[model samples]
Target chain A: MTAPAAPQTAPSPAAAPAGAPAVIRAIHLSKVYELGAQQVRALDDVSLEIGKGEYVAIMGPSGSGKSTLMNVLGCLDVPSSGEYWLRGQEVSKLSEDELAEIRNREIGFVFQTFHLLARQTALRNVELPLVYGAVRADERRARALELLRQVGLEKRADHKPNELSGGERQRVAIARALVNRPALLLADEPTGNLDSRTGKEILELLDRLHGEGHTILLVTHDPEVGRRAARTVRVRDGRIESDAPNR
Target chain B: MIALLEGVRIALQAIWGQKLRSALTLLCVIIAILSIIAVVSVLDGMDLYVREEVAGAGANVFTLRRVDELKVLTDLQVFLDSLGNPRITLADWKALRAEMTLAEFVDPLRSRSGDLQAVRDGRSIRNVDLQGRGAEYPGIEDLDLERGRHLTQADIDQRREVLVIGAQVAETLFPGVDPLGQKVRLSGRHYEVVGVFARRSNVLGQDRNIFAILPLSALFAQFGSFRSISVQVKAKSLGDFAAALDEARTIMRVRHGLRPQDPDDFNLTTAEQFLTLWEKISSGIFATLIGVVSITLVVGGIIIMNVMLVSVTERTREVGLRKALGARRGMILFQFLVESVTLTSVGGVVGIVLGFAAAFLIGAFSPLPYSVKPWSIVSALVIVFAVGVFFGLYPASRAARLQPVEALRRE
Candidate 1:
């Protein structure tokens, strides 16, 4: 258990206007996973557009393919058919290594499980993305320390994941996600494992990041969580049911 | 280089995490390398010792004896057959000395070795090696005198009962006093000491300076002339050696009157032949041992491969996470390869140290000397490093080829 960190100065917002061009454009994207003799449509003809500095949530029930949609959007899995263009680059047909490079430079992922490496300290976890980016050691440390400070975890930088509480771990994950300064921040059920009080705190942290003009695409099944986003897209049976603003 | 360092750091953590398993794997590698190092070191030491101390004094010299060959000691039938060969006598020595153009010296020597005693001033030394040599024996062998003189042609012609004593014999009988002109009793007869040979250290752990020598004629007068003798012959130079041997062999065959198709009745032992025989024996042993150690090393390598496979399986999710973080397949492969190399190299170093200790202990307690050859150390390290790379390839590539999404999805 640890005391909550003091709030620091707010992070600068992303430099994109309200009517900026799209950051991600999925045109007729379909993902079909083959299991033995059966083919499951994980994503079916999904067409969507997300501009820079927008906070959007894709919501659905179990088996509705929201996770698959998030994976495709995060460049983790390729769609079976479609033209997926990210920042004017057609990436749906990219090679494995090239996609990995795209994921490192253009997208940041925050998993539901808070997937922090168990052995490393919080500071090292925050520095993980920068390490893959081939950042120099001194610069990597300084950037990681600054991100930790932004997440109000500078005082706990040396603590491993097992020593931190659930909320602190999620905060460390958020710090790691932003360390690369990616174009899109994609989180899957970011507050799924926290209590109501801690969950609210994480939600507030997400809201603060969104307010800073960061492009946030969150995936969840809970409507109350979806209601926090500025825009919501509903999916059912691998197809979008509705796309609308929260108001 | 960064990947190499990180790979080593990760490997150490993994090894430390599984202490007993890593230790057992390392032990297997150590034993395999230790046997090779120890055996090579002993062989190297013995080769040098035999060449310098044992065979060096007899360089350019060869011996003609009644026995057919040195290998007669290994076969009973050969020994029995050679027993019927005529004794090498003074006649053969004289013929070779007079007829050979390539010959430097020809000396006849007869040895008596069982339960001989030398007594001087009532002080006795038992089991003394007693030998009789012709006047030119010193010229054919490294028989330097500590004082006085060697046997002269006059001593042999007059049949004088004069002796030359080894340093050990002199020490035991004369102690602090001068041995020159002193009388020592041997075989119920007294002989005046004319010379004393300088002290010599042991060869193959057996002392050399424990013998007494007498003039050939005087020895025949006392012990009769029926004993088997060896004719030692030296060539003028290395160029003359082969021709000298051929000439001596032809002369002896003519003297014995052997038929054209018949084998020679006597044996010839040269310094080169003795060294070659030793090399054949030592190399035979080394080849068999190396074959065995190679199998052990391969087994050790298999163990490493198995352990690495287990490690990759255990860390599948971590590999997925690393891949997700943008680590390429080559990076993953390099990391695991570095790990395996570090493991085997560590084992190689430990084995060399332990092998050196084992060699030193054996040399200290026994007659076989020990030397650590630089090439052996280099070869041992190279062998283990190659094992690591060869065995580690499959597991590392398996780890590298893992699909990132599937690996990450695995619980």
Candidate 2:
């Protein structure tokens, strides 16, 4: 299935039922931390709606709770005292197993570190999600090879992650993220470990994916990266400072 | 379930990464199974030899001796009481042989208590077992002559000073030169060698080739009177053996006037009894072997658990990466369990190979034949697998319990 599979506009007024969901909707979401005696708020009273086929960047400096919002939005973590609805289902009350099922089926995560299993080849690493998805070995191998070809790494499909350059590793991670054809591509600092020359190449890949009607959420501390998105949400001090559409 | 194959692949890779440590960990388990199998094989071989060779070959042949005790010595009271009881003698043998209608042959055999020596022209062999036998003894005991002729009934009727030595005694006393008709002195009495026995069977690791046999009449004439001796009785066939044994027992009991309530003072030893006694002894040895081996497995398992825990801690980041890639906790747990089972099962296979080699060595160099009990091998596999599962649980679960975020951040 492709992104915007059941596209719903952001906060439609009286045109749709209350039960209809956008791609992602968070209502008064909050996350509190308990470090010894201190209760630091990671997210507080944040409400947001992300529709289908939207490239949204959550930009913030360190400790500005952008990571927290990304985790909550990707279903890696649950928010405190709030409701999170993804693909028309409330997930705040879901158990860990249910949340894991949601993550595997609905969200594709791209990490800054690449997180490729070091011992496995690029093809094997790409096929990991399909393995957990109960796909047969022959089909998984074929699909993983296809994904590698899309990222222009067909020749390097048998190479381990360490054998590849930083940009190549990021591309492999992107291929892995899209292998499951998840509705939302959630990338957390997809180019944080790359140089500017390599980082721009990764951003170009993201731009092409978005052009093909993929919903992308890029979280970064760099403003240059944030500006590439059509919509940017700037977070500071555990709250959103700006939510605006860019040209 | 499909991921089990992948789990095995991962486990193999992990073991390959630490080859030396894996070998060392397997050493304890290897040695445990090796020694257990080797020891059990030896005991099993002994039981085989006891049944096949030492039980006197044929089921129709049985011995009537003084004591029923097979391996364990009789208690002091039983021994003292047996000493008071009448010794099995020539008259008792004759009387028992006369009353048996189903009997084929009865041979009276008298053995000297201490060691006997034979000397010929300054060459002497000490520790030669001396037994005086009737002419029927050769047929009943199946002693094949390698040289010369057996003592005829005339040798016993005339009370001739004729002797038959074993092949080894002939080799020791009269090497190279003809031992037939050679005179050998025993206890200051000279006797002409009439026959030599063939070296065929090895019994209880003792040299049966060092036997010295003489006529019972000559033995009585030289040693005053026959006192303590055993009589071997052979039945006509397997079908009538029970009736033959009952007739002998009845004649003997009537001769001794044994009351119904009183147990027979004489002991009856059948080939079956000897085999059962061996089984009892070997099973005890097997039990002891299992006890010693289980200790090794316990110690080995504890070491494996410690090593696995360290491995889990070392590979925490890899676990986090797998979990993030959609692996469930059960998958992670199964992966580690497979690793340990692979380690021990590999050890078990190696141990069995080494154990068979050891048994072969014993068979090649020693009198004991290499006998491997099938159950011992099955138990070794079952035991090693159990140790792996039992010891690997804590570490595997610890690895599975690690949170993806926490593990990803670990060094």
Compared with the true structure, what per-residue lDDT tens digits does model 2 show for residues A72-99?
Answer: 8988778986888888789988976677
Model 1: fnat (fraction of native contacts): 0.33
Candidate 1's displacement at residue B22, Å, is 4.7
In order, the TM-score of chain B in each prediction is: 0.85, 0.93
Q: Model 1, A18-132: lDDT tens per residue?
A: 4544687777789999999999998998877777788888999989999889888888789999878787678999987787788878888787888888888999888877776
Q: Interface RMSD for each candidate model?
A: 1.8, 1.7
Model 2, span B1-411: residue lDDT tens:
557777888889998888888888889778877887888788778777777676747689877777655534425566556665678888888886787788788888887732334455678877777788887876787788888988888998898989888888888888797888888877778889988888766655777788788988888887868477788899989789888888888888888899988877886678877777667767888788778877877888998898789879989988887776667788889999998888888888889889889998988888778798789799889988988888999999999888776787677
Candidate that would win on DockQ = 2
Query: Per-prediction DockQ, in order?
Result: 0.35, 0.41
In model 2 chain B, where is the ten-residue run with the lowest total lDDT?
B112-121
Assess candidate 1 and give its lDDT: 0.84
Q: Local distance difference test, per candidate?
A: 0.84, 0.82
Clashing pairs in 2: none
What digit string (tens of lDDT, one per residue) describes model 1 on residues B161-191?
A: 9989899988888889999998888778888
True contacts kept of each: 0.33, 0.22
Mark the 10 consecutive residues where model 1 chain B has the least summed lDDT. B112-121
